[model samples]
Target: MGESVAWVAVDWGTSNVRAWGVSADGGIVASARSEAGMARLTPEAYPAALDLLLTDMAIPAGAPLEVLICGMAGARQGWREAPYLEVPAELGGLALSAVEPLGTRPGLSARIQPGVCHKGVGSEDVMRGEETQLLGLSRLLPGFSGLAVLPGTHCKWAELDGRRLTRFGSAMTGEVFEALAQHTVLRHSLAGDVVESEREAGFDDGVEAALARPERLLSSLFRVRTGALLSGKSPSWCRGFLSGLLIGTEIAGFRNWGGDEEVPLIGSTALCALYGRGLAAIGRKSRIVDATDCTLAGLRAARELL
Candidate 1:
């Protein structure tokens, strides 16, 4: 690679696209982002969106670009699908090379990283892009072992043995919350916003209810609505109650299936706080790490092998 060639990092998920230009030492020299996410574009439009981003970011044509992308953009429906490397493989084993257009430019090169998958005991789960974050976490928290939770639309509970991803599970907590708040009968019982104090108060209650009977999760969710309408609880508090219930249930279910006690949460600050409060309510402690940094750190780690 030429000394002046610019290395690029991308974290393209279902809802967002982010890119950064990095120096040899991995310092971000420039960055850009957009909403042209995987869900919004057809296969043919993928190259167009990338072109626009590069143009908007003023990445000059003819400048050699080495790109590493993570997230859903590597899924079957996204740019291209990357195959999962089974457990016991090093992070480097996750690498896959595929060419993508550089905007409208010809002869440009781009590469997408594959997600990870696990199957066992009649259950299986997969994660796109988050595996990169897990690798980043491994580097950031050297010698760290046990479970790391990446919470978002699809929550990822990853088991790490050193730098390797041993196993993982996914929870659709965020999506479920969105559907309940917008489309379900429970919508009437929740407020426009979730109050932190109320979430704190009901955090443990939610976790407890979830762990009490795993099969009764649906019925327990209905109780949140009933508690609001019949018992005269504030709609806002009810929202918090519902939040606690779902998150708690996730925590409880994972714990039942062997989630580690001391977990590292990787996500936004707000989600991390919510998770922290829920864990506290359940008498568990956790460490919080920034998902964005993890994304960049992961891309940087992957670039080292290029």
Candidate 2:
């Protein structure tokens, strides 16, 4: 795609940075990525990171390029603090809440998109990259109303009513799985990466068990260890079972907390597939939306507001 770059969109997360060169109509014409995510950069070091991804674009001459970013780059500990937009907020105007950083490269205007916060809901919860993806769904399909799940290290379940993110919740499914599989007795039994027949069966079994008794999650967790020791379960099965148990428990908890409409899972393909499987296990349904598509649409949406 040798099209001239009219603007740039970026999703700057904790571990990496991605950029897309777009035409005036917001169609992505070029793309690149860098390892210099927020966790590796200080305020002054941000420009070089941007430089890594914004180079050699067919930028229009004598015109300043526009750059819109979302994700951890806006966190308090990120490149620059872009603050959080309090909940009950409409998704369309996220860019209005964004903040301009002081030291972008020459001929570039940059703003970091703000995250959303829910202070007085059931508990205090906040999100960064996930919000842009949510906004993208509304952009990709206007007047879209329903529940959406953005799954990752901390999976977010957000509610959309009348185009506003009315309320949402987060689940630490990935982190918990990491801890339980590496630090506990379960680690010894979850050392394999193969997902053959035994693994798939274990996964389904774990999901069913969680949905059947969401209340007994704690006790069910230990079953991995016992099954491995006495029942002669394979390490692959333990991995699948532990993964299913955590993801299934999360789905069950969400169902208990009013997750009734069709959920469009916004994230990577493989992760969303796993969530889709878990949902199908409990008689629920979901659709997958690639995170790249969401980020681009979201950044474009934010750019239009500017």
Candidate 3:
């Protein structure tokens, strides 16, 4: 029954949970979302949170609904620990490693897919949600190879050889931006909303400054405040400048990892667009993949294997 419900897919992150009703043909029939993410819930609370999200769905009675999930829900502090599979792992193998959470509701089966762990690299890193998205990307571009950059709170740059993930590195760019804008002196420099053109210009300028002289990152950050005071730059410009500087520095480091090729950027549309700009600044190209589509495809891919 291609038109009937086949299963459910959930991307449960730290701040939000989004679910999709997938049909037998892999198309999404319905969807739901909630703010009860892993960061704010205890293990005991996971079931209720999920129940609240699924209560209004149109799944048929007595149907065997398989709920496949990815992201922080599999973390040690999340719903249940889905131990990470080490790198050089095949993207399609995630389904075999899925772990079922205890205390799930009756008549509803759920499996949380494990994230990937990379050790012998730049940083001892772990990624839960992104691995699933990468799986989706693999399905989207069959036999694809190269780097996939997923930008967000903790940006990840993963190198893929075919469907196998070779190695990866992460950057705390987004988190750092939030910290600087809220806790540091830079907050004063980035105070208000900016026009679209001014934001883009400020962002581009920051990218150029960071790439041209990365060693002076700290000093350049301070210049945001100084520029605001002396040059009378608006807060929006300062904010855009700060964003570009952080993102550009991150890209400058990663662009040289492989070659200056078209990298696949996956994440939220806005964040991916931001990373795309930063990539272009480094003479690199990027293809944006909608984060939700990747997550859904990844979940469906895992479900099919099961």
Ranking by TM-score: 3, 2, 1
TM-score of each: 0.90, 0.93, 0.94
Highest-TM-score candidate: 3
What lDDT score belongs to each candidate, Candidate 1 first? 0.76, 0.83, 0.85
Q: After superposition, how far is residue 27 of candidate 3 from its true place, in Å?
A: 1.7
Q: Pick the candidate with the highest lDDT.
A: 3
Clashes per candidate (backbone, < 3 Å): 2, 0, 0
Per-residue CA lDDT of model 3 for 1-306, tens digit only, reads: 323667888999999999887877777878889998888999999988887767656555445578889999999999899999998888788988989998877788998999999776556789998988888888888777888999999999998876688888899999999999899988877777668887888898899998888878888998789879999988878888999999988887876665655789998888899999988876778999888778887887777766
Cα RMSD for candidates in order? 2.8, 2.1, 2.0
Ranking by lDDT: 3, 2, 1
The ten-residue window of minimal lDDT in model 1 covers 96-105
Q: Where in model 3 is the C-alpha error above 4 Å?
A: 1-3, 60-63
Model 3 whole-model lDDT (C-alpha atoms): 0.85
TM-score of 3: 0.94
**Model 2 per-residue lDDT tens digits across residues 1-306:** 534677788899899988888887767788888888889999889877787676645444336887888999898888889888888877678888889987776777888889999888469999998888887888876777878888898999988874588888999998898888889988888877686888888888899899899788899999899989899989888888888888899999988543556678887788788899998887778889877788787777766765
Segments in model 2 whose C-alpha atoms lie over 4 Å from true places:
1-3, 56-63, 257-260
lDDT of 2 at 231: 96
lDDT of 1 by residue, 91-143 (tens): 65555443343343464577888777765657777888888898888778888
